[model samples]
Target chain A: MIHRLIYPCEQAAKLSSRAMEQALTMPERVRLRLHLMMCERCTNFSRQIEFLRRASRKIPEVLENDAD
Target chain B: MAKYLGARFARCHETGITTRSISTMAEDDDLAQSLETHRKYLQRYAQFHLRDPSLAEDAVQDTLVAALSQRDRFQGRSQLRTWLTGILKHKVIDLMRSRDRALPPDAFSLDQDNNSAEGAFDAGGNWVDPPADWGKPDAALEASQFWRVYQECCQRMSRRDALVYSMREVMGLSSEEICKKIEITTTNLHVILFRARQSLRTCISKNWFGTQHD
Candidate 1:
């Protein structure tokens, strides 16, 4: 049961994206935080996805033709 | 200043000069022309929701016409893109509602390419190819070419995933609202959102960040 608190990179990545839409359970949050502490790649993945969300909100403004 | 200009404009209308009317017509033309500039962007917006190019085009046409007719209602309080996006959202929903009735039995059938990223992970749920570091991603936000690449990556997603992802991200719908709109369970919505984000992250990292990403 204690090992369940240690999420793998894939589960950590999913939890990170899920965090954007909804709150995670306490154990799930702890698991994700623990995995992220040791995983540099998943940390980058989490940050990049948050950035993706921000960039997506700007799609309307960015899609316009500036040359026009 | 606007009131004085309106009073002068009223006199111009009462005088009925050919030059004044012609100039007014020219102003209308200019407005249409400026509105025309947004057509490509509007078409892309419609396509994101409608999923069919011809239908998207029709929706954009209707939106532009409605915008032109109701141009006075646009008080410039918000960004013009925001206002136009609001109008386009309505047009997209209306089109979707109408099309739903006439859709064939297989309208929602899955695409040939599932485009699932489930294979990206190994048996132990580790990334097959771990994510690359994207330094200063905010800088890419300012580059128009980067947007083109980003949109291309979005388009590469399967239709169902794209619809769900766009509804959540681009439309800014709440998770509950997106689940209701797409008729999916919250669990299913989370899975789709996860895949969509993962796919987009890998695509953007490869195409934009990782010069050496294989």
Candidate 2:
């Protein structure tokens, strides 16, 4: 029997959506955690999402404070 | 005594955090100070969302006027900032929609080739090069400079594209809700977001990253 990936591509995309909000449903959360345990690519993608979030936050603060 | 305690607890639960109570409490505070605080944040939030300093100032003033007029309706369930931001968002949408109507047919040609949409990293998942250190003694200065460039690039985008990107990436709105608010299909939303990001990325590279020849 083929061992199906815990989170398939479409489901992984949904997981990414939840991950963007840093909120995941119980079952989806479990599946994402399980997948991340075995998948390096997904793990890297998660890190990228987090980096993007942090980087974006700086833009508004900077614009607001600019003297020029 | 136990019965009296239970009754008190039930009453406390029953009367929990009503909008009327919060509004009354808010009204009892320093109105001027509260309005000033709202103005400061609203100015910043509007600047970020609208990317036009003059427009942002106008939006902040408008938000204050509206909020003051609607003070009686403020239940205080949400933070004042959130409430003010909601007002500014609506104002921005109105502004953009009106501006869209005034544009000529060819004013917004969507044919520009956006080359930066692909991953900034290579196969090894490393940035083409680590971001350059500006060699500024003050980290804050470096950060501020980069942010100015970022803001400028974001402002260059069309209003619809910028709105989609800001709502999705910066504000963290879900795609479905963004689609509903922006009145576009999911595919169109994705394309807009992709193009917006690509434009921003290219702009940042050109302005901040310096050229390969440099």
- B-chain TM-score for every candidate: 0.63, 0.62
Q: Which runs of model 2 end up more than 4 angstroms from their true locations? A: A1-50, A60-68, B1-29, B51-54, B105-142, B209-214
After TM-score superposition, the amount by which residue B195's alpha carbon in candidate 2 deviates from its true location, in angstroms, is 1.1
Per-residue lDDT over B30-63 for candidate 2, one digit per residue giving the tens place of the 0 to 100 score: 4435766657666777777776788777777667
Task: Give per-residue CA lDDT, model 2, range A12-65, as digits (tens).
Answer: 533554555445678777777777686665554455444444667555555456
How many backbone collisions does model 2 have? 0
Estimate every model's Cα lDDT from 0 to 1. Answer: 0.76, 0.60
Fnat for the candidates in order: 0.82, 0.11
Per-residue error for B169 in candidate 2, Å, reads 2.2
DockQ of 1: 0.67
Give a tens-digit lDDT track for model 1, residues B1-214.
2233345446655776455557666775675676766777888888766769999988887777777668788877877667788888767766776766576747544433442365878877778988878878898887777876788899787666777787788878799977776577887787788888988888888888875422
